[model samples]
Every structure is written in C-alpha cells, then in structure tokens.
Target chain A: MRTNLMMTAAAGAILATGMTTAAMADGHATDLTLCWAAWDPANSLIELSKDFEEQSGHTMNFEFVPWTSFADRMLNELNSGGQLCDLMIGDSQWIGGGAENGHYVKLNDFFDANGITMDDFLPATVTGYAEWPKNTPNYYALPAYADVVGWTYRKDWFERPELQVEFMDTYGRALDVPANLAELKDIAEFFQGRDIDGTTVYGAAIYTERGSEGITMGVTNVLYNYGFEYENPDQPYDIDGFVNSAGAVEGLQFYKDLYDVGTPPGSSNWYMGENIDAYRSGQVAMQMNFAFIWPGVEADENVGGGNSGYFPNPAGPAGQFAQLGGQGISVVAYSEKQDAALEYIQWFAQPEVQQRWWDLGGASALRAVVEDPDFATSQPYAQTFLDSMAIVKDFWAEPAYADLLIPMQERMHNFVIAGDGTAQEALDGLVRDWIEVFEDEGKI
Target chain B: MTYSPIDRAAAKTPDGVARRIRGLSDRTIAWIFVAPTIFLLLAVNIFPLIWTIRLSFTNFRVNRPNNAVEWVGLRNYERILTDPDVWNTMQATAHFLIWTITLQVLIGFTLAYLINKKFRGNDLWTTIIVFPMMLSPAVVGNFWTFLYQPQIGLFNYVVAFFTGVDPASFSMIGDVHLAPWAIVIADTWMWTPFVMLICLAGLRSIPDSIYEAAECDRASKWRQFWTITIPMALPFLMLAVLFRGIENFKMFDLVVQLTGGGPGNTTTLTSIDLKREAFEKWRTGYSSAYAVILFVTVFGLASIYVKALNKVKER
Candidate 1:
C-alpha cells in the first residue's frame, strides 16, 4: 500500500514537470530558422520577416544557399534529418520526395485548425507546390511563390524603325511580341548577328545549362507546347508515345534550331544567370527566363525602364505552355519549433501580408493578392506573370524526380548542344530511361 | 630516484593510479598509446569500407530510409558494366587520364630539366611556375572558364592569333570535340608544376660524380642523359606518374567547374558520374557498388604500379 502511494506521487510529480516544461515552452520565444535559395526574393522575404519577428517576439534566422547548390545542400540537410531549418521553401519538384520521405509536416490539419484554406491560393500554385499526388486535396505545404518561364525582350530595339522595317521585310510580319513559337523563332533569327548601336547582338539567350535543372526547365517550356506529356492521361506511367510523340520531336528540334541559329557564341551552357548577363550586357535581344527576373530586369540600369518587355512563352503548334518555377513553404518535420513555424505560415497566408509580399518584390501565390483588380497594372510584368502562371506546367514531381531529371538533362544536352543523335532518338532514350526508373520504383 | 619530467609527473599521481601504471606490461602500455589511433581508423576508414561492401549487394536509398531494403547481388555491378553510357564515361575518363598524365609528365620533366640547368632567375621562374599549383583547383577551374570564353577570352584570342580564325567562332567549353581538350588543358596547366617539383627533387638528388664519371668514360652528354639521368630518375618519374594517374582518375572539382560534364558528358569523369548516382539520384546502394568497383580498379592498378616502382628502386 505504501509503495503504491509513493508510485502515484512520483507519477504525479513527473506529470507536473512535463506540464510545467510545456507551459514554459509555449510562453518562451523561439529562434526559428528558415531556409531558402539566396536570391532577390529571399532578400525581400528577409525584409518581410522582420514584421513577423516583431509581432511574435521570436527571432528568425535565414539560411540561403545559391540556386546551383541550394537543392543539393538543402535536400542533403533534410535527408539527414538535420534540424537546421524550422521552415523550408523547397522547390516544387521536391514536393513528392518531401512528402513521401516525411521531410515536410502534413499541413492539412494545421490549415484546418488555423483556418488557412488552400482555396485562397492560385490553383496552379496549390497543385504545383503544395499537393504531392498533384490535384489531390492532400496538402504538404503552402504555395509561397508563383513563377513561370517567361521572355524578356529588348523593347527599345524592337521599337526602332530601322530594325522594325528590316524585320518586317525579312519575316513579312510586324516585329511585336511573338504570338507563337514560329514567330518567336523568326524574331530570333532576324536579330541574330544584327548590329545594334555598333555592337553585334545575338537573338536570344536560351537555357542550355548542363548542370542542375536549367536545360530541363528550358526545354520543357518548348516540349509541353509541342504535345510532350509526362504520361498518358488515362494510364499513369504509360509514357512511350506521349513522351516521344512526333510533335515532341518537332519541339526538341525547334529548341535545337533556336540554340544553333539564335544564341550568342559560347552560350552553349547558359542558364538563368548567364542569360541575365547576356541580356544586361546587350549580347542578346531576347532572354527566356523565369518571371522572378522580371523585377530585376525592370530595375537594371541598362535593360530597365521601357527598354525591356515581358511576355509568356509564345504558343506552339499544339498549345501554349510555360515551365513552372516556384517553391512552397513548409514546416520541416524534424523541426522542434513547428508550432512557431506554423504560426509564421498562418501569418504569411493572410491577405494583407500577401499583398505586402507582392509589394516587396515577392511573387505571392495568394489568389487574393494576385486576383485583385489592380494586380494587372501593379507592375509591367504583372500581367505576363499572370498569363504565364495560367499556362504553367511543371516537370515530374515524383519521389524519383532527380533520377528523372538527371537523365532528361543528359539526353537534352546531348542531343541539343552536343549535336549527338536525332531528336527522336533523344526522346526515345529518355523514355527508356524513365521506364527503367519507373520499373525500379514499382510504378510501371 | 632521479627521474625525467614524465616520470616526475607520473610520480605525482595518486598511489592507486601509480600502482596500476606500474602493474601494466609493455605490450599493454603500447596498446594504450595506440588504442586511440586504432579506434579512429576503425571508425573512420575500415568500418565505412566494410559497411560499403555490405551495402553493395542491397537496394538501399539514403533519401528513402522508410523504404524496405532488398538484396540484389551483383545487379548494380552488372548494370554499370554493361551500360553504354557508363562505358562512354569510362572512355572519357580514360581520354582525360591518358592525355593529362602524358602531357604533364612530358612538360614537367622538360621544365625540370631546364630549371636544373641553374640559369639566372631560376628561383623566380620556379616560383612563377608553381603559382598555378598553389591556387585552389576550383579557382583555377573558374578563371580558366573566363580564359576559355569565346569572344573576350585571352586564350581564344591567342588561338585566333596563331590560327587566323575568328575569336568568336569556336567555344572551348561549349563544343563537344573541344570540351574534353579544354579540361585537359586546364588540368595540365594547373598540375604540371606538381610533377615538375617531384622531377626537380629527383634531378637534384643525382650526384655530380656520376656525370663526372660518365664524362671520364668518354660518354657524350646525350649518352649521359639516356644512361645516367634517365635510369636514375626512372623511379621518381614512375612515382610522379603514379600520383598523377591516381589523382586524375578521381578528378572532380576542376573539370566540374570547367564544363560540368558537358557538351553532353564529354568531360564526365567517373567521379562526377558516381557523384550523380550517389547524391543526386540518392541510389546509395548502387553508388556503393560503383564506389567498390572504382576502389578495386584503383587499388589493383596502384598495386601493380607500386610493384613496378619497387623493382625500379631495387635496380
């Protein structure tokens, strides 16, 4: 009887200690770490996060890696179950891996408890960035940025009378924003090796970067419009015809043609940064890049003002589509300060905060902000951003996305840049590679 | 009793500790001294190697820890060996290895021979030659990209000057045919001095008496070079080859920063390919198998080379 009484008291004391610790934790301030790629938007986020810091009385630390190494570094951190990041703005392609590997906290319940609705966000952003099974209501993250592949052109040069007349005489069309990929090609060809202000300029700076995801991101913008589907709509993983369709081959060839006859010399391995440099330095008349660079181009001394114009990727034979490029913010499963991280998400999802995010150079995915009546006229590229997002298609968001991506990068680079094999052969090889991957994954 | 500082220090210890120390055997004391190093080796080196070998037969992914692991003996090895792309990468590596070694050795030996002539500004020339070696491989890779740039690059301009070709017509890193050579040239430029220093050491170690004796025997300079210098420095030359061969086989950063294994895998060395498999693809077990194959190839070749080196030394 005495032993039982002592045991009960000990248990009660332990319970009291637990409650006290929990209460103390809830009352105390936390140092939350948010990880993302170091870019202009990340800087804007830093400025915006200061408000959250003051409101919550919690410190916010940022770990921003460069675009090239961000995935490798951050993914490694997540896979190792490192507690470095309480919040992560991970790439969209990582959604499947993040959810499957339990690197991200499932936000469905969190959203319910916090009155955060996915309906308030853009459908494409939700589908691309938040949902793992894609289009399913199952949520792993909240859409943080809305970005898509878009074009920036030398509007000043396009408006020039001599160039316009010459372009019209050559292509038999007004040199305006290309209504289609064919017209875009004509523009690119017309601008190739043209003299502008005593400097020889090239047509465009397209992504041909071999490392990481640059080329894949660039090529897919063409591929999707040319009827390159990831899989058959009726049958998941049935991609033989869909991936290597005749239209897809044409798309691949078109991209290769643009690469060969359009881009500047030594642009065989260009990416976003390289393209930006090419455009800013007047080496190229047009640049294909993500919409996020629009603001930077608008602010640049050389390419800024009304000199540059933005447009969504022009239509192709099959349809109009752009490659999606954005990330979603999620609470890392390994984080100890998940409550604080969730609070931050709740605060970020507010309409007012999202409006401020847009104002501060963030590509806010909130429909409440983007769908506002004044949003289209907010910035010169705002309408282009909207159009691009509407037509955005993303790469495979499978758990094996890296495997899928690496092969595509190799095949695309080999065919397009290395001048190896035919376009059909390249796409066929990719099909075989992806099939093997799917077989290994037991998804075939 | 008179004692050393260590002994005095030991003597100041508590009686129980002192007694225990005195009770230990010489072997135990030796083991006590070596235990930490042994433990470290086991933990850092031997353990991982053994673990890697064990993992080679399984289908385990590091990123998908929740997934079930399955044993698939020799499958990864078979796939790697039979894959044409793998073979292509191997060919690229071979091309890199052969060219870099041959070029570095030839140029290095020549430079070392010239420097050993002990002319004016010899130290200055040697220091200048070694500057490229002193810089980080990553830095060399980065700057060389600029140098190899098509239009504004000094290298392209120099080539154009010699060949009378347009400066902007060809891209060293952007063309498949030239990308391999681009990495080779950059690597040779950066690492040639390392080989030079080794050859210089070897050259310096040879005594003047040997040359004097050769001259006394009515041997010509060419004969002395072929007979005395070549034979004497064979081991060092072999040593330099062995080091450079191994280093070039695992070359990653310099080439990666230069071409990123492109113009479509023209410069994709096995190290870069293995990195893609291991980290980017997260195929841990498959990459472990890949690593094992590489380790065995390197070990077997190095063993043969070392045997030859020992024989040369004996001669």
Candidate 2:
C-alpha cells in the first residue's frame, strides 16, 4: 500500500509540473522586461510605463545599463540568446545588426496588424532608427527618441559691450550666433584665452574622446557640412575620393585647428560629459553637444536661462548638417512574451503618450508632438533641436558598423588630438581600413 | 555538558545519515569534497581557454556567429604575428612593464628597509604608505586624470610653482610624449605600496642574530647592508618584481582609465589592443590568436622566473 502511494504521488507531481508549464504557455498574464541605457530619459520612460502595467496587469521590469557599457551589455545578451530583455531601446546603428541577426522581432507585420503607420514618424527618424538595410521601408523598430548635434553658447559673454566691440574689430563681424563654421572659428579664436570676472576662460569644448567614437561623431558634423560622403551612392563601399575629398580634408583641418588653439587645456579627451562640465563650470565660451543635454545646461545655475543661447550646427563650405543621435524601441525576438512587448510599443506610440514623453523630459521623435506650436516654446533649446533635426545625417548602421566606426575613430583622434600627420593621409588610411574590412566581410 | 557547535550539529543529525557519512572511506570523502572545485575550474578556466584556442584557428566573429565559421589554419596567427599594430602594442607593454617594475621594486624595498628599522611611529608610516594601494585602482586612475590636468589641477600648479613654467602650456595626458610616463607614474603610485608590504614581511623575517654576529665581526653599517641585508632581501624583491611584471603586462583598467592608450596610441598596451579587437571590433578569431600569443609569452616567462625564484629561495 505504501509503495502504491509513493508511485501515485510521483506521477501526480510530474503531471502537475507539465500542466503548470502548459498553463503558463497558454494566454496567461506574464511579466515583461524592457532594457535601455541608464539616462534621465530612461527614468522618464519607466515613469511612463506605469499606466501600461496597470492596464495590462503585467509588471514591467527594466534593466538600465550605464551609457558607456549599454551597447556591450545589451548586445552580449542578444547574441547569447539571453531572455533578460523583452523590449530594447537600441541605438540607431544597432537596427541593421539586430534585424539581420533576428535578435529583433520584425515589426512591419505587427505595425500593420495594430494600425500603426510609419508615415506618422518624422522622415529622418524613420530612415535612421526604424529602417533596416537603410533607405528600405522594412521596419524592425519603432522610432522612440530623436536627437542631433547642436551648440550651446554663453549668451552673457557674447552680449558684453567691450567683448562685442573687440570681436567685431578682430573678425569684422558682431559677436552673435555664428552663421557658418568660419564665424564659429572666429568667435572661438576671440575667446580662446581671456580673463572674465577674475577667471581665465577658454573657447569652445568639442568632442575629442579617443577610446570610443567621440571624435568621429563630432568631426562628422563638420565633415558632412563640408561634403564628406561615406560612399558614392551608385557604388557602395567606394569611399576613396568621397571621404578624402579636398573639401573634407579642409573641414577636418578646421576642426583640428579649433582643437589645437581654441580648446581649454586637457580638452584633447573631452566628450559629452566633459563638454557639459566645461560649459557648466563657466570654463568655456561655447559647447557642442547633443540636444539631450540642453535641458540640463539651461537649468544650470552658472550658465542657464537668458545667460545661455542655443543654435544648430553652423554650416560648413558645402552645406549645413548635423550628426544624428537617437535610438529606437524594438522587441527582442528571443522574448517569450513578445505579444505583451508589442502591446507595450503600441501603447507607447499613442499621441497622448508621446506628448507626455516629451513633457516628462524624453525627446519625442513624433512629428505631431514636436511640431505642436506650444512645443517649440516649451524650452529654450526646443526650436534649435527642431531646426537641427531638419538637416541630420546618420553614421552607417551596417551589421559591421563597428568595423567601420573604429578605424575612423582611431584615424580622426590620431590626427585631431595627437596632431599627427595631415588630414589627407588620415583619410586615406581610413579608406584602406574600410576596404579591407569590407573585403573580409565578402561585401566587395 | 560541553557540546561545541560542531558537536551539537553532529548530534542533531539522524543516526542513519551520520552512519552513512561515516561509512564512506576517507579517499571517497576527499574525492567528493574535491569534485566541485575541479568541476568549477574546468568549467570556468579550462573550457573557455580551450574554446578560445580552437576558435583561434577559424575565421570567426562574435557578432556574425550565424555565418559559417571557416577554418583557416594558422591564418589568424600569421596575421597577428605580422601585424605592425600588434608589435607597437607589445613595445608599449614592454616599456610599461620594465619602468613600473623597476621603479616599484626600488622604491618599495627602500621604504620597507626603513620601516624595518623599528623607528618611532613606524606603524603609522607603514599605514600611510600602504594607503594608496588600498584604494580602488579605477578610482585612482580616474582622479589622476584631473590631477594631471594642465589648467586647474593641483599637480600642474605644484609643478608650476617649482619649475616656473606656466601650467597651461602643457598637458600630461594630452601630449603623446608625456602620456606613457604619466601612466607609468599613476601605476607606480598605486602598486608600489603592495611591493613594500611584501618586502616588509621579508625584512621582518630576517633574524636579528645575523646582524649582531656581523657587528661582532666589526662590519661597518654600509658593509653589513651590502653583505647581509641585500642578499637576504633579494628573494622578496625578485618576487615583488615578478608579481608586478605579470600584473603590469595585463594592465587594462588603470591605463584605460588614465590615457586610454591615447594621444595617438602612444600608450596602447597589448591587453588594450586585444580588447579593442575582441569586444570593440568583434574580431573574435583574430583577437583569440592575439590572446594565445600573449598567454604563451607571459606563461613561458613566468615559468622560467618561478624556477629562478625557487633557486633563490633555496639559497
């Protein structure tokens, strides 16, 4: 009787485990996880997800990695088939790799099924964040955030009567918001090293970080404005003449000149944080950074409110442009709860949710939300952000984007910061590196 | 009445369970106890290393793992061996290893010798000297960047005060010529105390009777130092050198924090280059070959050094 009882108990336990697994696999309530960089915007996003949780009855979990390690950590999770993330806010450059690797759920069908239309998003954002095999209409993500390179300058310094007269005398132009790169350089030169209120201040702080992709991102702003194209549109991967053109070389030289003479001491390794610190500490006359930091800069005690002014990236020889900076939201393909994740995206795409996203400090990629007349007047830098987004270009989002970015970073940093060799030579070497990598990938 | 915790725990165990444990042979128990550790070692260390070695012979990529992993025997090795960039990194590693080890051993041994004198407040001085080593290297490496700043850094201000040169005229981390030495200085500052602690132990281990006998022989203080102290402390000094040499070779975090092998790759060590290739560039096979070469170089050199250390200890 005891033996019979033991066998009966064992069979019941196995059957119960099977039934529970089946129950969970059926349409039961589930927990969904979202991952993103640990930034101010991520906090706003988490706050916004509460409503979704309440209605869906699925508690939303978040894994926020610091920006420095965000790519490394999240990509590792996706590549290793980890189920830690149901939703991901991936960088714009990650769309190609994520889509190609099947790490992200292809969202075209989902969007169609849910009445979500790509025509609603800004054109640039759709091309930048949502498209895979870029310029193609295949959607793998929803454009969640949009940002671009822009400038913030000390308005009080430019408005000083004596300084304004001196700048005019020196550069034959009034001290005001620069209309082009030449005027920007002139203003930077004028303020390179001057005493202000018993403190010696330097000129502008620009990106020059060496370890990662700081210089490439910053220099590309100037490069794009000066006619630097990654490849001939007709012939892909042919970067020889386009990337190393005489105009591109001049632009790179101009950046190098600014870095050498205008920047503060130890500015050779400055990036976003360093630029923010320099601007906030009243150590610099101007700072070039992304729009995300503008809110913080305007709220700063030292140089904020009417004391600071913001503008789009000044034009170069060929035309004006800014490097794109933003990310898109995608559902991880490996997630078991992709339906719930897709539901979250649909809810997030609502116009009301988008308006709240912007109001809560998250940059909105939706045209309807940002184009609201009240939105431009919302903050001091909002108009500048809208203007900058109009002429934005993005870096390559190829699956092997790192292979392309690392060489440019190394070459640009070596020339710009280290002051080694000419811009022509650096660009040539970069072309060689790109071609070699492309050949290895069987792309050539 | 006098039940210890272990005894009480054993007493509480069921008789059948206790009897079963006791029935196992000592060898069997030892094997059971050792099994988990061996398994962990194989899982963590040996398995990954073997996998890396196998992948080193293939044309593979971490990011492109779905693609076919083509076997190109010795091609990855060939490229790494012939690459000038790899050579540059090796040169940098050698420079850092040599200077840091030499400086640390010299400075650490001298301080250890002084502290071993049993002077007043010796313990306090030891604690003060050992303080820098106790702080996190990441923190030290980061703050050192500020300290090396040309304009507002105290380091530059102090240098200006002494040398009468303008602080804003130069930057330690920004200049390629000075960046390597800047890293050398930062690493030495953080690690010299570790060597000093080891040397201090060596110093205290020497019996006082030997010095007393030397004094009876009418040996002068300087002579005694050369004949007795130097020889006796040699083994410990070598140990410290070996430890520091191995450490500075694989130096990643501190240099990354300090210079990031920057100012035009002036300070890019092998480990930094390897990391860039592996994680940053995602060149798994190429970086694996690089890693294998570095492992062989370090392991072979360390094996020989260990043999020498053993000989010194025997003496």
Candidate 3:
C-alpha cells in the first residue's frame, strides 16, 4: 500500500510536469503548420523537425496528405487564402500558379536577407521547381526535393544465363540495361509474358492513370527524349508543328506500343502507388517510376537490394531527358506566422541539416548535399539518381498549368490506352486544346 | 391576432423564461426552432447555388482570382454547350446510367422476389447480400481495383477457373471496350441490394387479400405474379430507379477509383469532367456553367419523372 501510494505520487508529478511543459510551449512557442504530401520523406521531415522546434521555441504542425489528394487539398487552401498552412512543399508544377496568384510569398528577398543563394541548389531543380517564367532567376520557392523519373529493372532476371542466351539469340544482343528507347521496348517485349522461376511476370508497369496528371508525367519522359517541346521558343502557342512533330508522334506511338503490348493485363490507369505495388510484388519485370519510389523499392524484400537494376530514362532519337519530379518549399502569403516559416526554411537550408535529412531518407535539392563525393556510393541507386538529375526537364509551370495539362492528359490517354485515334491526331487535338486555353488566359 | 388561452395564461406565469417561451405563437416558435436549419440551408445550399450561377456568367478562373472577372454573358454557356468533350462525358454518363439501372432493376427485383418467399435461411442471405452497400464507395472502388487485377486479382482468377482461359488474356479495366461494362458491373453489385431492399418493402406491403382473391378466381401463381405482384411493386421499383438514376448520374468516386474514367475517355462521366475543369483545371466559371447545365438536365428530367410517378400512384 505504501509502495502503491509512492507510485501514484510519481505518476501525478509526471502528469503535472507534462502539463506545465505543454503550457509553457503554448505560451512561448509559435505554432506553425507545414503541408506536404504524405510520402516516406514526410516522415523524415517530421523526425528532422524536432531540432527546429527545440532550438527555435516553435511548434511544427504538419499536414501530410496522400499524393493523390495533396494538390487538390493544398491548392484549395492556397486559393481560399487559408492561414492553415504557414509553409507548403508544393509541387514543382505549382510554382507558376502559386507565385503569380500571390499564394506564395516571394522568396528572393528572404533568400537575400537570409543568405540563402539560389546558386547553392542544383540548376535543374532551381529551373524546374523554383523559377516561374522558365529560365528567369525570379525566385519564388526553394527547391526542397529533387527527383526524376527513372527505371528500375529486374537485374537478377536479366543476368540469368539461359535467359540472357535466349535474349541474345532472339535480339542478337546480350540482355542489359537499355541505353535507348528502342532497346527498352525490346527488353520490355522479351520479358512481357515470360516466366521466371515458375512465376508469371509482365513487362514494365508504367503510369496510365487518367483522372489527373499520371499519364502526362509518364509520357513526357519519352516525349522529351524525342524532342517534344511544349511550344516553339520563337513562336509561343504556334504548337502545330512543335507539339505534333513527326518525332513526337513516333515517341508517343512507341509508348502506346509498350503499354498496349508489353505491360501486364489490367495495368491501365496505374499511377505511382500501383507501380510501386507491382514492383514490390514481383509482378513486373521493370517499372518506370519516379525516384521517390526508389527508397521503398530498394527496401522491398522481393525486389530490393542487388536484385534490381537502376538507370536513367534511355535516350530517344533526338536526345535523353527524364521528366522532373520534385517540389519547392514556400511560405504561404496569408500565413500569419511568415517569420517563423522563414526561420524554418533558413534552418532547413543548413548543410549539416541537409546531410542529416539525406540520412533520414530525404532527397534534398542542395547541390552541396547531392554532389558530395561520397554521395554517389551512399546508396545503391544514388549514382543513377545523380545521372538522372543531370538531364531533367519539367512540364509547363504556367499559372494556368492545369488548363494546359488536363487536355493533354485526356488526349494522350485516349490515344494510348483507348486507341481512339492516331498519335498525330491526338497531338493535333492537344495543340488545339492548348491553344484555346492559352487564348482564354490571354497568354498568346 | 388574439392570443390563445394557453398563451395568455403562460404570458402571465411567474417564471420569466417560461413566460417568454410561451408568449410566442406556434408559427413564431416554429420559425425560432427552425432558424438554424434555415440559416444552414442558405449558407451551404442556396448561397452556393446562387454564387455558382453568378460565376457561370463570367470568365473567372478560380486559381486566378486576382485577374479581372470579365463579364462574358452566355459565352461560358455557349462554349460548354458546343464542347465535344463535354458532350462525350454526357453520353458516357447516360450510358452508365441506363445500363446500371437496367441491370440493378432486373437483378434487384429478382433477388427481392426470391427472398420474399419463405426460405430456411432468408435473413442470413439477405444480410450477406446487403453487405456490399454498407461499405464506403471509395474503399469498395479501391478493393475492386485489386479484385479486377488481371495478373493476381481474384476476379480474373475466378473467371479463369470457371472458363478455362488464362487470367491475363483479357483486362477488364484496361480494355477500352470492357471498362464501361466493368463500371456498370461494379455499380450494379454495390447498389442492387438497395433496390432489392426497396423491392422487398414493396412485396411485403402488397395486401395478401388480393392474392387470396386471385386464388379465389383460380388465377395461377405465375398469372397472379404477372398481373398482381408486379403491378403492386411497380411504384416502389420506380422510386428505386429514380434514386439510383440520380445517384448514378453523378457517379464519380467508384468509377473513378475503379477505372479513373479510363481505358481513355470511354468512361469519362460528366461529374469527373466537371471536377477536372473546376478543381483540377480551376476553370471555375466554365465548370460552373457545366454544373448549371447538369443541374438543369437532372432537375428537369426528375421533375418530369416525378410527375409521371405521381400519375402512376394516382392510377
């Protein structure tokens, strides 16, 4: 009874101490909310924020939503001028919309005042995720995470002696990581319906999700390699020849061929999550997915470690480039706690913290962090990541980016999956749609 | 108006709060009690509808609120009316609506008829049949994506097991020709039970004396079913059809989760397209116009349908 009384007393003291600490935090600390997609990196950010909270006497509230609904939820928050999110790790595509509409606070002054130079980050990321008018140095947000669409293949399956011999005999080449779009197509076909260890596997699992930006994101990787520009640099919105170029049509057709003949059954309408699931389940021989998926793939028991091979997107006829996939960190303009938000950004930019962030599974956009000599050997797929980031391009970041995106998504999906028309016809329709949207926006 | 005796007595009562409460007439008290509901209706429903209609007249993009909201009267409506893609979505919505309703009505009424008869384990079977409707449509759509997986999904495996065909030979959601039907099948599966329940209610409500009189007239069971049972259940079945019709007309989540309006624009229903324009594209004015068009279509059709339904009831 005496011991029980002592224990009760200790518990009461602990509870009192907790309440006192919380009350102190509530009084002294500024509560700031940071919003981003609920991906693996968000957990790393959560773990990394403890130091920020402890040092700055500020509480970090996080609003991590699923990738599917992240844009809708966050954009609605920004559009309505809600103060719920003080900071947002917005999609790279949103830079134009976020910047132009005053949804995001201009970060040029913050970077200047805080000694955060744009040159410290990778050029591709700054251009893709931060800049609004394409090549302009007008800073809006700091490139928070740098990523690119790359391929992960079954290295074990490719290295099998009998399989290699069969592939060599059939295609007159040894099976290896594809160096071009044609070779990738061939490899995908070779593994399309083949059995490995008595388990039936499909070719590659590529993105074909129609409702949003999935198919467009996936197809742009190939389209960029085939020299498909959004529009002519000299003549904007004069996209008839540029968007529906012979090479672009061929590239689109190639993608459709791969999807129509190579991918697994019921693989239509797949996006990031489905691609990861397919790879992890050993249902597909290859997966064309964003670098965000690499960590999870690398850790999966069936497909991770030395079992998989990583490579940047293969070159097409014109050139090679991977579609950029990343986000920028910006302070919301309406945020009452903008000062605290800037402070968090400044803390996040420190080299040591970036290094620790990388350690905690974040793909930092800092050149200093990513270009370290040891960074290449830090993880198995790190070298491929570095190479892929070397040749990265982004989609239209126009403030009216969605208006530009949705029609293309529809046209591409209609042609590629639905077989509604020829690739040329689809691109023709897309150009018409894009021209109308641009006219509506009074951009052209 | 003269006060009632009760109100006069309460107004003279000693308690102040009680006197105040009792001083109100029935109509005033009713208004006071329902004021919150009225406010909420105005806030959530009436105001948005008005705002949506107002926005439908302008060239305003939701994402670009700072930009000038141009007065382009009827332009937005004119564009939406002429847009081929919008019409395609309408056709898809209509196709989904007709097929799902037909299948649901047929299957639902059949199930209801079977269950209306005495059975050893009728309650258990009814509960099992109704289980799918209780699930969240999003969750059901997601799991159906798995179940429709050609390689590893149970749906194809079951089909293969019964048909002696490879599971990978055909893709339900991936095939353009099959995707619309896939959505139809899923909607039918989830909502047939709702129709069945309505039908069951209809069957149970049919006065047994009529059947007894039919028996007295030496009418066969089949003849009585054709003449008496169906005629009695017709109103309930029609009610179920109207509810399902409206719901399926705005079908977004399940079909979206299942096919994402894909295998191309084959399944791109109007709601998904409107959502894409409004939220995804942030073409607020254009989408508002689209919304107004859809509202008019559904409202007009429903009004006509209700009038017909009332006529049936009167008959």
Report the C-alpha displacement of residue B35, candidate 2, in angstroms: 4.1
Which tens-of-lDDT digit does each residue in A1-444 have in candidate 1? 335435644554454355345535678678999999998999999999987776666789999999988989999999999999999999999999999999999999999986789998999999999997998989999999889999999999999999888888888889999999988888898898888889989999999999899999999999999999999999999999999999999999999999999889898788989999999999998999998888999999999998999999999999999999999999999999998898789778767677788999999998867887889999999999999999989999999999999999999999999999999999999999999999999997
What stretches of model 3 exceed 4 Å from their correct place? Answer: A1-28, B1-39
**What is the Cα-based lDDT of residue A98 in candidate 3?**
90
If both were scored by lDDT, which would come out higher, candidate 1 or candidate 2?
1
Positional deviation of A7 in candidate 1, in angstroms?
55
For candidate 2, the lDDT comes to: 0.88
TM-score of chain B of each: 0.95, 0.93, 0.93
After superposition, the stretches of candidate 2 with alpha carbons farther than 4 Å from their true spots are A1-29, B1-35
Q: Write the per-residue lDDT of candidate 2 for residues B126-221, one digit (tens) a residue.
A: 899999998887899998998999988888899899999999988999998889899999999999999999898888888999999999999999
Task: Give one digit per residue, the lDDT tens place, for model 3 in A63-143.
Answer: 999987888899999999999999999999999989899999888888888678989889999998888777887888888
Scored on chain A only, each candidate's TM-score is: 0.94, 0.92, 0.93
